[model samples]
Target: MSVDDFKHRGRRKMLVDLLRTKGIEDEKVLEAINLVPRHLFLDSAFIEYAYKDEAFPIAAGQTISHPFTVAFQTQLLDIHPNEKVLEIGTGSGYQTAVLVGLGAEVFTIERQKDLFDFSKIMLKKINFEPRYQTYGDGYKGLPSFAPFDKIIVTAGAPEIPNELLNQLKVGGIMVIPVGEESQQMLVIIKLSENQYEHYEFGNFKFVPMLERRDK
Candidate 1:
């Protein structure tokens, strides 16, 4: 954990202003972004650049999504308080904290062991304890915790995982990025048991979502 003093808070306010200009209109989403201490989510050397609306390198060869991207996806989720939100990649727990701050009951998964471990401790240190944090395959989703109210995948996938789609409750929404390289942000609204509505929100890049290869 790192100190979040006036310096970091001022930077975050500026970042929120930048995000506003970038079209992040959800006040709750913007407030969450402003509240979470992104500087603490990065390595010390890059702390100065933490609130610059840019992605920074983190453990497990992953990059935290830029603040704009995070806010965009979050705004698309249309999260409501107490919603059961499943986060597919807990890189640095930054987004998870944002969700928690938005009053969602978050269940986050991290397939990379290093990140899974680091984030578990980091989140605890800051007291942003999500409802559940698991080290497992994102493609598999969380069966026992099925029927999430909203789901956010933090990585780029070659295609949307049907397994995850199965875990969503009817009338829920899922915001994911799908592509081989740069991904188009997709919003999947579960209409019924077998019905869904899909929409795209332009292209963005993210760390590729990884799966566990069975032997």
Candidate 2:
């Protein structure tokens, strides 16, 4: 049975409220979070706690990110309508759905075949169509579609990849986490061809960004 009903909406509203209390001030981000049925992105076993601000395991040993983490990173991006967004890790595609709801032209990538397939099915089912998605290396952000208005890496990178920086449009922003075990959420703004600005938010834990395609 479809769970995207009244109860789910209520939970989402409460989740948004919690995000607000936790310092997510962006109305657009909150609205997008409210509209997306986060429950639909989890396994049936985790459905009960899907609305809670916690990460839960999905397929391929990956976990869906906490709602707060999603909101925080999204707020940092300062997304504008019709902006082209390169999402490094599609995971459950929950973030991609939120990005599309925020009016971005999203291009997402996922390495795990199971997750790539799952996100494809779920996104199509919900009508959250990103402009493009592929199974590839996140380290080499979509060079063919370079100059993206924004780029978001959903996993924790040990070091910033220069390729992703190159893919970002001049003056564009990229929100990523850098570290091992735990990460510091970093918001990077490409100032010029070789210059960039960065700000580190607090720490967060995400599935480690793996190397190459997981075939």
Candidate 3:
């Protein structure tokens, strides 16, 4: 490995350590976070800060989520190998890459066309192939690919969308942030055919989950 590659690996290890200190205890989630190079998903200008547990602006006014947020959400999902997972936002594709690394069959959607296109290229370049990388409204979810084992929403929604709940398989989990401009509640829902359970994990801030595509 080159000097830069070695440095990046060291930074990833440090990042994993930080995540552990912050309560991210899922070994699989930590492994995936370390394996996927977060810097590659960021703009070159912000590459140096890639491993920090912080969010950064990306194209289409979106931001790549903080590492802690990503790890937190992924850990909540409790992903299993080859399980079908629906991701509501594909901004920067960093989270998608981590999910892919964790052995989930990822189907991710982005509302902004620019981010959709950019993330597709970035994920492909990194050899992180999601089952589907779509450009569409996240609120709609992906009906055709319904009944996912898990669902993750990267943006903050005003409320949980019924469409997403409908797409989740019975006993599946969905992690989302729900609120307006300020702090949002990190919600986890475990769905059954006729009933669902909700768990709130305190506050987190995310870009608003917009409806329709930005043309």
Candidate 4:
């Protein structure tokens, strides 16, 4: 490995250590985070700060989520290998890549065309292939690929969309951040055919989930 590659490996290890300190206990989640190079998902100028436990600005005015947030949401999903997972916001595709690394069959949607296109190429270049990457409204989810075993929404929504809940399979789980301005509640919903259970995991801030595509 080159000097840079060695440095990044050390950075990733430190990041994993930080996450563990922050109460992220899932071994698989930590392994996936360690394997994927977060710096590669960042702009060259911000690459140096990629492993920090903080969000960073990406294209389309979206922020790649802080590492802890990503781990928190992914842990809530409790993903199993080969399970179909729908991600509501692709963002910088960093979270998507982490999902792919964990062996989930990922379907991610992005409202910003620039981010959608950019993330598509970035993920491909990194060899992390999401099953479907769509540029459309996240509130609509992806009905065509309904009944996903797991769903994760990276953006904060004012209200949880019924459409997304409908797409989740009975016995599946959906983790989302819901609120308007200020802090948002990180909610986990477990669905059954006729009933569902809700769990709140405190507050987190995220970019708003917009209704329309970026023009």
Candidate 5:
């Protein structure tokens, strides 16, 4: 069979397996996973593995997040239909596209120019373009698009970014991975005007969150 055909079949089956076993309970998120063409976001060589619940290398030393991770994080956000979202590290635009499919007005940032450009093209190709902008420094988040209703960081940071926390609107949620070495924790931070509530779900590992590589 053709590579494209294989990818389509393989990814569909993988999505089914993920929902069946990964404890991913949200129907809307599952449908988005089923509907989004994950293979298109990956390089042709790795397209066959697109649907498996695993991260794959993308350009600029970044990796596309696993499908379960994407679904789990999206579920944590509890995003409303009209909510605005800020995504840090738009590696392959896969995660961004998922959020868009969930009806979010997304704003994303990537520090790697190559990945940023590639994701921009892919976003346009998939019609997943965010509302306000995409940037090269994810650490800074999007101050211009401040007060986002939800924020999801796809990479691992040593600690949660204070700037990103500040940008979330009251009652907004930010899902991120925090760690230093091998293991990272998926943390959900719910913002309030005066206080924040945090919940750490489980362990994970991701590409390190970067500042400006140029600098």
Candidate 6:
């Protein structure tokens, strides 16, 4: 096969593996992951490996998370078709695109200026740019758009921010990876006033969440 044909087939195979083998069975999320061109989200130098279920470095010493991570994180959000969601880390906009494709009205924030710029452009390129209320500091959830039905933090935090918890509506859910040296991902579900439940899923390493002093 020609080089171009080989790459196309490889991407298709990757998609199948993600759905059938990786346990990403949500039809909506799977379809979105397949529809959004992963190659377009990576640097031209890494485009050939874009479809692989792996992480790749981007600017700002950050990496676009693995595709399985994206699917799992998104699935944990339990998004409703028209729910408003807040994403703390935009990264490469791959996760943002998936959220939008799942029919959630997303309000995403990115602290790193270069990453913010890149994600904005890439999201627009795929016509998947969400409600995009970018901020430099993700520690403070988008309070102005508070009462988000769901909030997802892509970066790992030492602890859940009070502001983020306050932003969630009663009976809402927030998926975050929290830790200092090691990370444990969990889903926090708000039961009602002064009541919340937490479930630990698994352990994973991720870029530490940083506070943007200038934001």
Better of 2 and 5 by TM-score: 2
Clashes of each: 0, 0, 0, 0, 0, 0
lDDT of 4 by residue, 8-94 (tens): 999999999999999999999999999898888888888888899999999988899999999989998899999999999898799
Worst 10 residues of 1 by lDDT: 206-215
Candidate 5 stretches greater than 4 Å from native:
1-10, 212-215
Residue-wise lDDT of candidate 6 within 102-210, one digit each (tens)? 8899999999888898889878866898986585789987888899999999998999888899999998999999998778999999998678999998997889999
**Residue-level error in angstroms, candidate 3, position 160:** 0.6
lDDT for each candidate structure:
0.92, 0.92, 0.88, 0.88, 0.79, 0.84
Candidate 6: misplaced stretches above 4 Å?
A: 1-13
Error of 4 at 17 (Å): 0.7
Give a tens-digit lDDT track for model 1, residues 1-215.
Answer: 45999999999999999999999999999999988999888988898899897898898899988999999999999999999999999998999999999999999998888888888998999888899999888898888998899999999999999998999999999999999879999999999988999999999998898855631
186 Cα displacement, candidate 4 (Å): 3.9
As for model 3, its CA RMSD to the true structure in angstroms is 2.1
lDDT of 5 by residue, 120-177 (tens): 8877876877675565688888888788889998888888888888898887888888
Candidate 3 per-residue lDDT, tens place, 59-134, comes to: 8888999999999999989999999999999998899999999999999998888888888997888799899988
Q: RMSD to native for every prediction?
A: 1.2, 1.1, 2.1, 2.1, 2.4, 2.8
What 10-residue stretch in candidate 4 is worst by lDDT? 182-191
| Poorly placed runs, candidate 2 (over 4 Å) | 213-215
TM-score of every prediction relative to native = 0.97, 0.97, 0.94, 0.94, 0.90, 0.92
Which residue segments of model 3 deviate by more than 4 Å?
1-4, 212-215
